[model samples]
Target: MNLPEILADLQLILEEYQSRLDHYSDQVFMLSPEIGCWSMAEVYSHVFGTCLMQQKAMEMCMQGQGMEGSAGLNEMGDKLFALGHFPPGKYEAPEALKSRVQNIHKEDAKALATKLLSRIKSVQSEDILNANEDQRMEHPRLGFLNASQWVHFMLIHTKHHLNQLDRIERKFSMC
Candidate 1:
């Protein structure tokens, strides 16, 4: 997607997430739908935190700090962008990163979501728009992506989690 489209979608998804924060009671937010699954709070925390990290990567690219090379997206990255979303299935974070996912408070989650939205908005500046398209950062699973691709990935990632959120809510209602 183009920058404007990416920004609009990002804004909508982030606002949707922020609006739903109040819908969850503390118990529901912290409740895991099943054993070995993340609670809604953990999901929110992970999504927002990962988006922020992606934003920083974008910023680094804008500042010309990205790796200088003709490195292109790996096969997985090409497929992901072509599909414009994650494939259906469960994905596990690396073992080291798994511990970073925590049961966050609803208020804290809301604040992080807000910050991510703000960061997305800030990326519309001239510098970010003019960032070196050839410069790239490597994502462990997805391969190297430039600034615009990073923004697109952020949108895809958040939308992917909406389904997970729905499943969690449904499980909560069933209990």
Candidate 2:
């Protein structure tokens, strides 16, 4: 997609996430409402952390040091944008992030998410846009991706979690 289209979709997804958050009361947002279920706060925190990591990866690519030159890796990146997400139950968070996931306060989640959204917006700038498309970085599971693919992955990743948030909202009757 072109820059405007990408930016619009990114903005749309971020707005949708914020709107979902708006529907939940503070108490409701904090409730898991089921065993092994994550609270809305934890969900937001996870998304925020993932976006932060993506941002760092983009920065690394700009520095000419993160590219791993994985063969056939662009196809993996294409599949992510095409499929929208990893198949449910088919992927797991790394052990380090597992413990970091927790029930953050509502305000804190909003702040983190807002900051991430802002970074998403910043990617439209010329310098970021012109970053080496040939540069690649290795993902733990999805394999190698270039700078634009990283941003696209952020969009696909947010979209994947939006569905989970919808179900959680319904489970708690917040939707």
Candidate 3:
């Protein structure tokens, strides 16, 4: 897909996520009926964390001469997901998410999205298609992803969390 399409989808996903947060944040964090599931607060935190990590990847890809070459992100991600989450994919439960990690997490998510948008806007077409394969970046969890996979992973991961965000909206939303 082209940049326009990729960006368009990202915008739509962000809108969906924002709407969910706006509708539910005021109520209380957890999936409603107070089921004590993953809180809206926690979901927000996770999405935010993931987005920040993604935005940070560009820098790592560009600068971190560490071991996280192209396939690094996937390998690390698969392992992390395998350890903590249930598949097909589900956000970790709030108790599972951390007690002290509320407001800070939410803020982190916002910062990540904001930064990601800034960096993404600066990406030239050539940069996207022409990044070196063996060129590597050391991410916090997933090590590195070649340029193409990183782009794909970034979009794919955003959509995945958007789905999670949607679920949180449905379960906890007042509407």
Candidate topping lDDT: 1
Off by over 4 Å in 3: 2-4, 29-36, 63-112, 138-143, 173-175
Instruction: Write the residue-wise lDDT of candidate 2 on 40-90 in tens digits.
Output: 888888888877888788777766667655553556556766776776763
lDDT of each: 0.85, 0.75, 0.56
Total clashing pairs in model 2: 0
94-164, model 1: which lDDT tens digit per residue?
Answer: 66557788899998998898898887877774565789887778777787888888888889999999888
Residues 53-112 of candidate 3 have per-residue lDDT tens digits of 555665455554434434555665666434433246454423433543454344455565
Worst ten in a row by lDDT for model 2: 68-77
The number of clashing residue pairs in model 1 is 0
| Top model number, TM-score | 1
lDDT (Cα) of model 2: 0.75
Model 2 lDDT at residue 99:
77
Error of 1 at 111 (Å): 1.4
